[model samples]
Target: MAGKTHDFLMVSKSILPEAILKTAKVKELLAQGEVYTIHEAVELVGLSRSAYYKYKDGVFPFYEASRERIITISLLLENKAGVLSHVLNFIASVKGNVLTINQGIPLQGVANVSISIETAGMADTPENLLAGLGEISGVRKIEVIGQT
Candidate 1:
C-alpha cells in the first residue's frame, strides 16, 4: 500500500511562568555546578535576571510567623554519644534554631533529652519538624511538650 498521511494537531494547554512553578531548577543548577553565575541561572529559568537577584533572599516556601512561641521537644534517644548530636543536626537542617538543651543521664540504654527551639525563621511548620524528628533512627520517642 502506497499512501501518505499529513495531520495537524492542536494542543491547547496554558503554560504559566516557569520561574513561578519551579524555582528549584535554578537552585539545582547552582548546586550541580551546571550554572556558575546568576546570569546563567536566570536565563535558564526564563526569568528576568534582575527579578532573580531581587527575590533570591526572600522567596521561600515555608512561611513562619514571628510569634513568641518556643517549642520544647523531648526526644528519647539511644544511649550513644552521636545520637544526641544527630538529633541536633536534624533540628538545624530544618532551620530550627536551638535555644537550650537538657539531657538526663543515660538510663536503660536510653537518654531523655529536652530541646527548646526557636522556629520563627524555619521554613517547615513545627508539626512537620516534629514528624521529621520522629522519623530519625535511634530516636525512641519524640514529643512536643510545650508550644506557645
Candidate 2:
C-alpha cells in the first residue's frame, strides 16, 4: 500500500463553491446520524443526489481525510537529547499509533528519522500533526515521506 495513497490538499471552505460545500454538509449529516439516507442527507443540505455522489468520495472534513490511513514522515533533527522522545510523545498525545521508527546515526550534528504512524485513532489531521511536530525544539525539517 505504500504507493497507493492519494495526495490531498487542505482548502478553506470559505473559498469553495456552494455545490462542493453542500456536498460536504450532506456527508456530515449522514455520518453523524442526522439523516437516514443519502437522499435524505442531500435533501437536508439542498444538494442534488447526483452532486452528492460526485463529491462525497472527494470531499471530507480534515479529521476524516486521514482516517484509517498510514503515513510515513521523515524528519531531520539536531543531535540533541530528548528530541526523538518528544517526537514520540507528541504522536502519542494525538493518539497516533507509531507502527515503526528508523533512526540513522547522527552525522555532522543531525540525524534522519523516519516514522510510520497509523492515523485511524488520531484526534488531529495529518497536516496538523506535521505542523505541531515542526514547532518542537531540535526539529530541523519535517516532510511526509509516504502514505497508504
Candidate 3:
C-alpha cells in the first residue's frame, strides 16, 4: 500500500446498496483468506475488476437490487450428510438458479462452501432467500459475499 490512497467507491457514499457492500466484502475476504485471490474474487462477485474496483469502497447492491443480481453465498456448515443437499433445495425453493458451488473438504466437522446463484428469476427477494437458508439445519453461517 502506497501513494495517496483512494477509496474505490464509485456511487455516492450515502446509504450504500447491497451489491457494492457485498463486493467490497469479497475484497476484504480475499485479503483475509476468508476467500481466495483476485480471479476467484472477481468471479465470485460477478464483477469486472473495473466495476468492482470502481465501487469496492463505495456503491452497494441491496435485496431490491438482488433482483437483477448474480451473487455468491459463502457458507460454513457442519459436515453432515444431506446438509449441502438441503441447502440446495432451499435455494431452489426460492427459485434461485444455481450457478456454481465449491466446497472444501471437511475439516473438524466443518466445511466451507461457496455457492453462486442468479437471483433474476428468484421467487423470493434476497433477504427472504437468506432467511430461508438460515433456517436450514447444518448451515452455520451464510454471507452474500459478492454481487453484481
Candidate 4:
C-alpha cells in the first residue's frame, strides 16, 4: 500500500543477504562515478537492475548514514572584510564540515548567508554550534533553517 509504513533496523553487513549487499555495492559504484550507467553498475556488483532499484533507497553504508546528518544555518552578517572567513573558521574549530555557502548581496550594510554543514564529526551539538556562530564578531544573528 502507498501509505504503508516500514520498519528499519541497523544490521551488520556480514549477516545481510547477498542481494542486499550487492545492492549496496551497486550504489557505491554509481556514486563514485566508476560506472556511468545503472546497467554497468549492477553488472559490476553482480546484481540485477531491478533488485538494485528495490533496495537502493532503503540501503546505505553506516558511515554514509552517519555522515549525512547536515544542518542549514542562516546568518545575518555585517558587510565587512573577513567576516565570512571568521565564521567558517569558527565552524571548523568545532569540527563542522561545510558543504555549501550562499551569500546574498549586501543590503543596508548586512548580508544574508546560508550555509549547509555536515555535523557528524563535530565535537559539539547543533545548539552549541549555533551559539558559537552567534559569538563571532561580525555575526549579527543566526538561526537553523533546516536539517537532515
Best by TM-score: 2
lDDT of 2 by residue, 71-93 (tens): 88999999999999999999999
Local distance difference test, per candidate? Answer: 0.72, 0.89, 0.80, 0.85
- Tell me the lDDT of model 3 at 103: 98
Q: Which stretches of candidate 3 lie over 4 Å from their true place?
A: 1-61
TM-scores for all candidates: the values are: 0.54, 0.64, 0.60, 0.55
* Tens-digit lDDT string for candidate 3 (37-137): 77788777676677677766543335645676788999999999999999999999888999999999999999999999999988888888888899999
Roughly what TM-score does model 3 have, to 2 decimal places? Answer: 0.60
lDDT tens per residue, model 1, 44-77: 7787876666555544332122233587878899
- Model 3 RMSD in Å is 14.4
Best by lDDT: 2
Model 3: clashing residue pairs?
9-58, 17-60, 17-61, 18-61, 18-62, 19-60, 19-61, 20-60, 20-61
Please list all clashing residue pairs in model 1, or write none if there are none. Answer: 69-148
Instruction: Assess candidate 1 and give its TM-score to the true structure.
Output: 0.54
Error of 1 at 93 (Å): 0.9
Which whole-number lDDT from 0 to 100 does residue 62 have in model 3?
59
The runs of at least 3 residues in candidate 1 whose Cα sits more than 4 Å from the true structure, single-residue gaps closed, are: 1-68
